[model samples]
Target: MTVHLQQEQQTMLWTLAMHAHDAASTRPILGDRYAADLLDRVDDPPRLGLSLAGNTPLICARAKLIDDAARAFLARHDEAVVLHLGCGLDSRLLRLDPGPGIRWFDVDQDPVIELRRELYGEREGATSVAASVTDPGWWAQVPDDVPRLVLAEGLLMYLDPEGVHTAVTHALTPGSTLVADTVAPWVTWIAGLQPAMRAADTGFLSSTNDLAAAAGAVNLEDELSLVDATATRTGGLTSTAIRLFALASGGRDAMVLRTYRRP
Candidate 1:
């Protein structure tokens, strides 16, 4: 619907764009059925031009990667605890619908959580926490001693380097898992130049090519690439460009998803 959000929160528009795109794609990346239902409820997602076009499929791919990681974590640890940090209006708990044993928390700012309550309802195992992720107070709400799966999708760049470290480091447990998407410095630069971002008064303030290093994770595994998945669906010059960008930047290292094991 017609929810009013601040400039920083307008980034939720990208979730809408990817949702609509995935629903419309021939080979839908994430196949987010819930996304279509939400789109029907929200206002028109603003046209972000090239950034929207390029990032839509990538966002879907990123979501898919996160879903896969969660599924894997859940498969191994039935007593898993999921924390989706900086969770916007997007509905991941509904998409996954983890078991009753798993305690899932969708964390975000008070305003967005308030909006979410109007737009969405309480889930059985999933609870929405209204607090800034940077604030350590909210961290106390989550339980300890479980297979924790912490997801920070399109989040860290909003926080500076120190905030990113604190958020991730706080959740790092020996057996816990962290799945995150980070942009390289070059990608951050391009995002700032985007018309849509400038219009919304939001831009990536922090970026790193190596998320594992930034998080100080002793064990790390690279997960998915936006270019890799999107290139499969692309053709002609578009496909060529995807390929070239990947090669030019060491296989789209600019924007990547990774899973880190807390040692």
Candidate 2:
């Protein structure tokens, strides 16, 4: 049986649908081949209009960038811990399939985690924690000793400023790496203007023009422009438009993927 999701939780389905759509395309960027199968199981999947469909490339590109960084981290560390905060129903654990030494944790709200469990049964090295990232107690469930890699893809903006700060500070242990994607302040405002977002009674709660200011104390290790990544992964007019937008000042930061390391 399928589970019911609240409006906010429905956002995960939209992203999953985007990944599934891209996988079926001729040249897929993210190449999450399992996305289509997962999405198909949903009782009523979200229908993507031009606006949402147009974002497929960017979303898939972001996923691809995160996957690459995650794979590299796993390669460098013999035994590691991965905290996928706001993991939703994405098949990241299955996609990466890290070896025995790695302990992977997929964290999310209680309801979302419930559905995820239904979709994905138990895996050897993976554990699903059903709790909010903002809750301090959830941190206790994760080990403090192991080297950590925190992934917060498409997660931070849904949180208010204080929540963002709390989650970040708690996630960054010594020698840990964090990879997250954030939209510019203007995009956050624009997201609020979307009719669909309003209808769903959900919208972006916070955004940061400068991630350094928002994350606090972490050293920025790398940054990738979603626009640039999308351009690189796509072709023809889509690539041209993305490249042109990137050329404009501050355009690359419009939606950025940032990698930070804790000292």
Candidate 3:
């Protein structure tokens, strides 16, 4: 079946394509073996050129980092709720395979959730919620009593400042943590210049240079630079260039994975 998506939603396919490419490569970073199969279900999936293909390491590395964090969080709390916001078509629930105690919710737009239902059907411990992450009403579906692990991978950059605040605020309940990947202010500007991004009419709408402000009253636990992770995951000339970029940019322009916590 053919899957239709809007410009921003199309990005999910691109990310999935990247995962599929990484899995096929000799030195796989994320090693998402299921990505290839998922990509196959999409009719006429996005074609990745060298420009898009180059993002494989960075994208896959981001996934790896989130996976590690989620796994660790699940191990710590036997009863927890995972809110994978803007989940798209990612098979992270399948990848992590958390124990029975964990309740995982994959949330996205209604259309995206409909597509996801068609693809994966019903899962044991995972539920797909069809609603915008910015909508406060969706929070009712989530259990606030359990330790919440809110994942906003590649999702926060698309929201405006107020929307980001809303997402962060709702996620910072007692004993909850929010892990999100956000682009820097400069990266948002740079994304506007990309021909591909421009052609798709979809670019980053928001960014944060200050992690503390982004975290608000919550404690900023950790920050991981995607550029640094890419350099480590991809050794060679690419690694050298990334290292130099990190030094020159001081990681201010790199995509950062940030963890925020509320005691």
Writing each residue's lDDT as its tens digit, candidate 3 over 1-263 gives 69888878988999999999999989999999889998998899989887788788899999999999999998899999999999998989989998999999999998999999998899898888998888999898799888999998899888888788788888888989999999888788888876667778898878864434656778889988888888999988988888888898446347889898899
Q: Which stretches of candidate 3 lie over 4 Å from their true place?
A: 209-214
Estimate the TM-score of every prediction. Answer: 0.92, 0.96, 0.96
For model 2, residues 67-88, the per-residue Cα lDDT tens digits are 9999999999879999999999
Question: How many backbone clashes can be found in candidate 3?
Answer: 0
Clashes of each: 2, 0, 0
List candidate 2 stretches off by more than 4 Å.
Answer: none
Query: Which is the winner by TM-score between candidate 1 and candidate 3?
Result: 3
Order of models, best TM-score first: 3, 2, 1
Give every collision pair in model 1.
Answer: 1-41, 1-42
Between candidates 1 and 2, the one scoring higher on lDDT is 2
> What are the per-residue Cα lDDT tens digits for candidate 1 across 157-192?
887777787787776766777888887787777888
Give the lDDT of residue 225 in candidate 2: 84
Off by over 4 Å in 1: 48-50, 233-237
What's the distance in Å from true for residue 93, model 2?
0.3
